[model samples]
Target: MTGIKMAAAVCVALFLIMPTIAIKNHDVTEELSDVPFISAADAAHMQEYVAFDTREKDAYQKEHVQDALSVPPAECSECLFDALDIYREMNILVYGADDAATADAVELLLKNGFERVWG
Candidate 1:
């Protein structure tokens, strides 16, 4: 009976933990891709879409993509979800000083359900 109880407890624990593990894995997978660099011309053309510069506020204030919104990497997701009211269908372009930061922003956007998320 004790062995059976142990097995049942283990099963319950796994059942509770599985979803969290899956969610974490999904989050990791979402952020694993490199963000593509968009050219100035292309960016110009897509001006209707929101362009986010995922850099520090100082760096963003210095200079960034023309007309791009300054959303620091740490606050990108919150800015998008809260301040911007960006719908999943909206074309959202995320960029940074380098690929890794851009990719991180993209992952966050994608995870948050932005369908047209691009970097």
Candidate 2:
């Protein structure tokens, strides 16, 4: 039984590690040159901007930036677009639970012609 458990653990570990090993590392600086991702500090310095909290409502309710609007893109996209339409001309700053989530929201906004979208 111990040997079987050990073997199962090893297989699980290998399964998780394989994808990371197979993927190629990207140069973040080069990739971000044209991207609108900005540091939190830089975002703070900006005077006029509408910050969108892309996390779930529960997360937003727990804790979020002052005046940040909760618009979870994955949950209700129609509402997200509607909200975007209202603030189309404003500088939009998006943040989520993870980098991928934030990136996806920013990309969606950009595709929909929302300028000045930052992740």
Off-target runs (Cα >4 Å) in candidate 1 are: 1-47, 77-80
Every candidate's CA RMSD: 20.2, 14.5
| Deviation from native of the Cα of residue 114 in model 1, angstroms | 0.9
C-alpha local distance difference test of each model:
0.56, 0.63
Candidate 1 worst ten-residue window by lDDT: 16-25
What lDDT is obtained when candidate 1 is compared to the true structure? 0.56
How many clashing residue pairs, candidate 2?
0
Which pairs of residues have clashing backbones in candidate 2? none
Error of 1 at 9 (Å): 60
TM-scores for all candidates: the values are 0.59, 0.67
Best candidate, TM-score-wise? 2
Residue 115 miss distance in model 1 (angstroms)? 1.0
